[model samples]
Target chain A: MGIQNKYYGWRWGEEDPIFKNLGYIQNVLGYIDPADKSFTSNNFKELFYPGDFDLLQKSWKKYKKGTDHAFEMSYRFKHKDGSWRWIKESGLANVFNTSNNPIGGIGTIQEVTDKKKKYTQLKSILKNVSIIILRLRQDSNNQITVDHISKEALKYWNIPCETLLKDEGYLRNLAHKDDLVGIRSALSNSFAKMEFFECRWRVVSKEGNINWCQGVGTPLKDKDGTCFLDIVITDITKEKLYTEQLKVSEEKYHSLFQHSPQPSWVYDLETLAFLNVNSAAISKYGYSKDEFMGMTLADIRPECELENLEIQVQKTRENYLNFFDGYFKHINKQGEILTVHLYSSPITYNGQKCRQIIAIDISEKMKYLKFIENQNKSLKRIGWMQSHELRAPLVRLMGLINLLTDQDSIGKEERHYINTEIINSANEMDIMTKNIAQIINDAQLKEKMNDVQIIAG
Target chain B: MTYRLLQVDDDPVILFLHNKLFSKYTNSKIEQFKNGRLALDYILIDNGPDISYLLLLDINMPVMNGWEFMDEICNHGLENSTSVIILTSSADCTDLDKSKSFANIVHFIQKPLTKEKIEKLPLLMEYLALQD
Candidate 1:
């Protein structure tokens, strides 16, 4: 898309909704009066910062000469509300379309106040930038001698500017001993290679504080054919400290992602492409890193589980706080299906909207639950045998005992037969009791197997 | 177009079976190799771009296995013109899924091919008709 099409997609008029609400107006450049229809550079200057206006003039000249395609600059501008607003202004000179002569320039102005606010806060630190500019001369012995120092050196090092003017070795002595070798080698290499030199080193101040400093230098020769280095030194202690802290925090975050017990990954919200995956995720899903990159989240899902995934994705988009924890079937590279429960959270990964998920494989848990259900059925069967089987045998023994009599009038043969039957009934009862006891013992052994404890390190 | 059948397998039995079976079809030449490296050299460099051959690839070999050979042929821009049908004993579904990534792979089949199984392949039938 061309720049003009992007910026001018909406025709500027009072009828346009955005322009009507924001009270946007456009004018031609170099016109004398604000009320005139023709644009004026003077009025444009009123809406821009001095640095931005200078950039516009330079870029505009280059565009007119066909050396540059477009001119773009962003800076603080006075808004309709009488407040300073940061805005970007872009221009393209001579937009050719069947024209013999050069056409007038076209441009766009947009409000970037929100993004500029962050830069403004940081800009406060640079209000009085104490950059110490210096010039150095190199002798034939490959020795560097400081020739001049800017007046700002006094404010930073607390030594008079003339002290550097008199003593050439004063600057080298101020640098920390540990940082000297690296800094000197970098400077010499840049000189020999005819490349720009930049390095950071620590400098010991007069107040006994060590400050991080950066030097950016360029090598040049004067009219007398003598080599010199023009360099800029800046105190960057706060920036260095902030960078170190940020690196440590990022390292801790990455380690946790890698060492977590569950398989985890981060995927783009729109495309569902995996942006990052942990080692556990790679091994569990049975895919190499390259294969994962080429696949979407849908590829791992079983066909039956895709509907639920679609619904969950919609709910997440509606509100990232609307979390989901549900079991879904996933297919591995080998076509073996696994059940997993995902704990997902919306995250911004590398500035793109994405989701981070910790997937817990629940296949083994499902198997364990099924095993317990089967065990319950066996226990019910054992209970039935203990209650019904013992009851029937006891009733038969009672009936047989009732038929025998204690009176002396009974026949001797009848009494002998009754005694024989009583012995037989007693033996049958003994066998049934032993069988019930054996069943109970077997049940106890099965229960003991469940006592095995699992420990994870 | 006349077709050439190139079989790469470490097992001597399978290689002999592939050569004996494929050579039965008229107007087609069958070449067998014990490993992927020799087949790759024949296809890409030895014959260059002038001659195109159908491949019977095996997953495991002594050197430069089938996967590495597939990667090489694709990188050399010979994948589109060449036809590959993996004939291996492995029934791994992972290999079937991975074959979709290559441009030339037409079929993934189990090994110990019989006369009936060979006739069932549509690509093989088309090539058989186009022989000479």
Candidate 2:
């Protein structure tokens, strides 16, 4: 056999068929000089990148000392363009010197630069990503161990990745005291059932900063009674805070709407349906909340004012942003017509274009104003009677008295005539006084009646 | 020129007092009517073309009023022939203000037709001048 055949089964160096056919092997075939601690190959001087000679010597010595079955190593080599390339070498040491020390070895070297580049890119992505990817293993004895944990956990939990991998308790300890038991149970359940694991827990960092996290993953059970759970955890603190704030704001507005003192309601613009009614509205309209919910804006208005209500509704829709103030005659459930001053503002409610209205029942005020007008007329008539009618008879009496006083002596006929005239004038004066009194009494009675009607209505 | 004096009132006593006062103070014969309608009729029926009548008209009458009589007087084109002094018991300034709107009205006088009041009337003084 040839010297290459003595080393393995093929002749190495210039006669090696694998090395000569670069298309088939695409690898470097080389021989190691164990005494000189050097590698010799077809292009060894040009290809060997020099920095890893110590590592190569250490790996070769291990194989020579029977620590490894084959001489296997990975080192950097120079590419044609002067860039370093990863090379994986594997060989058998079969040649020995005279003293029985292994002097030569044959190995095949293949470039692994693309594979190393891919591995390096994956490592970089895992280290910087906000999401923490973790793999946990559990044995039949229920012993839980962290198989792998990404470095991103250190950025959030402020704990080292090595510390978390060696002792899974450090990662578990980062959970809030209240969530520790839950986290343990979640893991136990996923391992027992080999199902998907999903949990949200609070993590308190070493610096006392608390963050909300959501973890989701699946568990796979192995034939050796070991289960593996690969979970991806994300910080959900921002999302949780936003949801809580929204809830608080909604509750605050709901309380304001429910407890308002004025009769208020919200109605849909298109259908005119009553979407919401406050406590004051329910009581004032003499309708229950459920009843109001079933009614429309037109239902509360008098039939005579229905056309006006539609025109106003159309105006409100066209100018939604305008603050509306107007008057309407509304009829309650008891059929009492109410004059209301309606103030409305447009708002988006429950994803519907709606208007919130505050109705001030001014029916009593209107009645009072009418009563005052009638009273004014009555007073005018009384004043006119006092000036003209009532005073006419008094003027006649005054004239008669003057006639009587001007005479020193009077005839019997003259005296009787004057007395009779005075009597008639006094009678007229008495009747006029009664008429004035009657007018005042009638006005007062009408005012009292109006007051009663206002209170009852 | 012939001159006449007329007293129109709903109260008979006021007319009687006016008759006594006018007869004593002036030469023209005093005509009495219970209301404006009667006074207005007497003037329309008996008043001659040459006779200019001085009417003392009272407001607040049963049938017709001082203002209504003036309205009729103006409507009939008798505003030039009739001189009216509003004789009313009303102390209200509104009635006095209303009297100024009529073209036939001469002055406003508060009632009880007194001798001194009748003498002070400018249209009644024309009748008194006729007596002199």
Candidate 3:
């Protein structure tokens, strides 16, 4: 013991000599020196913190009015070692005066230096803790009272430290307005079940910024068997914000991929498995959405083209994350071979790496191209025939025409020979001209027949 | 040894002009046929390349075309026996390419064969000198 004795008893108020000596004042209040009786209530009250002594006085006054209670409180007092130590004064005031009024308080004082030091250290640690800790209780009237709150509560609750020991209304206001009903219900449930209660909600700070917090409360009981809710609060704002952003981005991508006009599908690159297909792809491929889901890319290809499709599939192993364009001969549900053009790119869908493909129906374009090529080939053939067939007869006609123009030196036999040759060459030129016309008409008819065959085939 | 000009064409007028033109210019045996088949028949019998022979052939004829005529001459091992000239109105490049494929076809000339074109032919010049 730091003092001569470890404990003492004393009484004051209601009487003849207010300065009566009580033995061992050093032990009674850790005073180190004898207590001076001349001090007023104001001088003695100076030893306590603001409003802390008032609670002890209220309990003492209540005990003096014939109530069965005591002034039991912990307050700071000066120790003999010139340091402040906590003292617990616990005793009832006796109503032993002749006037039936109280004769002041009778109590034993204990120097709670070690207990107070430990409690203060725990409180200091709780204040600096990352997560907020709270002990709350409900009274008989069902009014909730916060029994204790650590300094950490002010980090997100936005309440002042001084007001935390006095009022709890600021903490209630810190809760988001929309989440009050849920929190009240959970609190009642937790109290009734005497189990852990957990929930997450947004809290609005004094600066009007909202932060998400998760609270977990466990049931606890004080010395008087009164139940209190002991809760731990954690700021979960980062996780909550990440989840919200993920949902928003997923919605954006879904709208972009679904509403595109081109026929589109996505497949897993490793397995060639269809992961997703849009409406345009379903209609263009002549398959229902379910049918597409069940089939691979190889299913729609013609049987004869399987070998080529396999080669292309194997090549996909090396080439990744590139824009690829190709023309494929595809067979639809109607067994019609259509020329399809594809544009593909790499993407990640639902955590699966895949390639997205956009297909275009180029059957009509190919048909028109083939028609033009056929017409061009025939046109070249007709031009060749016209030059060769007509030039031969034209050359002979020109030569014969030169002979016919010479009539002055010509005899009768020479004139007949010239006339016969001229007539023969002229008739040949007429036949050759007719042959050129027939050749062009034949080429046109042949082209038309081929066009009809293509449509039928 | 004799040097001869074999003018094989389907047109009688072309053959007559060819025979008359060479006869007016030089003393050479000029044989005209209506087709390549008759010309080939004459070459197999009497006319051979013991002399410097010049064969002026047309591509499109009645019995045997110029290409078939060259094929037959090659089969008979007579491709080296005569120097041939292709005279035709066919302006197709494939025919020119086909004509060059034959060893006997030394020149390809287009129709309306002029005196200058005939004089310009090395085969004709050789045959004319042989005649002298």
Candidate 4:
């Protein structure tokens, strides 16, 4: 039907057309007259496009034949603001009249441009988020599955999603066999407690390289009480290696502390109380673990020397001295005095004031020194005798000879006889002096030779 | 003119040698005192000669020592007419050290007196002459 004829004679349509101008009809699809009560040829051009009308007409005919008739189409329509808006038209056709003849259809028109634009933006956001996020899901059976993994996770796995997602054992296969039991236990415990959990485990990738992963997981429970785990995993290979190194260093320190040779001790310097002592210290000091802990540094020092030691210790605390070494008399548990050469130094220990002391018993050394001193006194006495009492006689004998030689006026024969006697007496004196010197030299050489023999032995 | 020289010694041989050596070696009259006490008594007499005399003192003697005789004579403050020289066979450093404490002691001689040691008395005679 022509637009003008349909609008001029619209007395049998369902409702009066609210808009009927030709320019409006050309740009917009306006309503028809209610009095017309039937779709005619003139109104068909204004009501729907040729393609839409054909489709609706065909659908209406199919509906009369008892076929399905609901369908939708989209087209551009002019709005009141003079802009073309994309509209989606959806309708259900009813071709049954009072006599069950094919008649008309009704539909809904919706502007879908804003909805389409928002859908496009949401898709882009999802795609970008997929690049960095790794999502995992675990079923009620503790079966881990990659629900929505990031592209980065796929790259890290070095496998396509088709190959990875098809295997229900994919995550379990990636977990190190040694850590699988522990990881499962932790995850189960977290699920039971409904708490978040974090764990470190090794993952063997598709490329057969082991990679450490730190996983943070939270449980999601449905209304039916079915719980599933959602986890995020990150590569923690560097952190795991560093932690292992720290563990090794701690073990080394522990070994050194336990097996060091010197009898080392750590104590509270301010209180003069022991905090820790090595095995050597306990054994050397002749005290058991309980007994040693019950005693203090003062208890170890001799009673007579404690007062002087206290003064020195106080000076050390005041920074007037930092280290000290001296003789200290230590009484063992059996009440035996052990003369120890004690060396002590100040150090900060485990956030406490402390001192470290090393002691070596020097009682045997002192005994040896006393023996040497007595020997030295005897040697000095011998030296005095040789230099004084023994020298006087030799001097006097020479003096007498000098007097005899100086005499003048004597016969040659008598002089020669006196000279012979003088020479004989001088020779006798020389023998006596040589004997005394030999005695002293022999004593000194004997001592030296014995020392050399001892060294060689 | 010769003067009397008294030689005191605990050893008979040393006394004989001193007497022989002094008489033979010098122009002097000789007297003998075996003990320092007897010499001290004889020299302390009131009518003792004012003539020049000499006394030879022997230390380390049996009855009376040279140091004792010197102490007694000096203590008596005797105006003696004799010069004294200490004669001994002792070569002890203590004896030599002790000799320096006496001002009257002329000389310290070792034992086994010889002719040469006697001849060296000329120097002592010269010293005595200077003293007179």
DockQ winner: 2
**Highest lDDT scorer:** 2
Can you list the residue pairs that collide in candidate 3?
none
Q: Go through the candidates in order and give each one's C-alpha lDDT.
A: 0.68, 0.76, 0.72, 0.62
Colliding pairs, model 2: none
Fnat per candidate, as a fraction, reads 0.00, 0.77, 0.48, 0.00
Interface C-alpha RMSD per candidate, 1 decimal: 34.1, 1.9, 2.8, 6.6
| Interface RMSD (one decimal) of model 2 | 1.9
lDDT of 2 by residue, A1-457 (tens): 0112112332222332223323212222222223533334455534556756556666655566673435667777664345676756677646666876654556665556777888788778866766888888987788889887777545756643556777758556557888988988998998888888999998877677888989899998778768888889888888999989988988997788888887899999999999999998998899999999999999999899999998988898899888978888999999989889999999899998899999999887888888899999998888888897788878888888878876854567877888998998899899988988899899989978987886775
lDDT of 4 at A257: 55
DockQ of every candidate: 0.00, 0.46, 0.28, 0.03
Error of 1 at A369 (Å): 2.2
lDDT of 1 by residue, A1-457 (tens): 0112124422212121213212243311122345754333335456665576566556545555665545666666554445666656665544444744345445566666666887565444433566777777777787778877666454655533456666765656547878888888887887777688898988876676888888898898778766788888888888999999978987997899988878999998888899988889899999998899888989999898899779878778788655667778899998879989888887888999898999999876776675577567666665655444443334334433443433343357756655665576577668867886776676567556544421220
lDDT of model 2, residue A30: 27
What does candidate 3's lDDT look like per residue over A1-457, in tens digits? 4543233334444421112222333354544344545334446556555676677667555555654545566666554355676656566555446865555555565557687889888777766655777777877666667777777556645644466556756355547888888887888898878889898877877788888888897877667767888888877888898989988987887777787787789988887878888887777778888888888888778988888877876677578767778998878777878788988888888788789988888887787787678778767867776667777777676655654554564568867766787788788778877876776687678778867977885
Order the numbered candidates by DockQ, best leading. Answer: 2, 3, 4, 1
lDDT accuracy of residue B45 in candidate 1: 56
Model 4: residues with Cα > 4 Å off, grouped in runs: A1-136, A148-167, A172-174, A195-198, A204-261, A315-327, A345-353, A397-457, B1-132
**lDDT (C-alpha) at residue A454 in model 4:** 48
Interface RMSD of 1: 34.1
Q: Rank the candidates by lDDT, best first.
A: 2, 3, 1, 4
Q: TM-score of chain B only, all predictions? A: 0.85, 0.87, 0.87, 0.77
Chain A fold similarity by TM-score, each prediction: 0.52, 0.64, 0.58, 0.51
Write one digit per residue (lDDT tens) for candidate 4, span A351-404: 776787777767656655654665576566555555534433444444445445
| Root-mean-square deviation (CA) per prediction | 36.5, 9.7, 10.5, 18.5
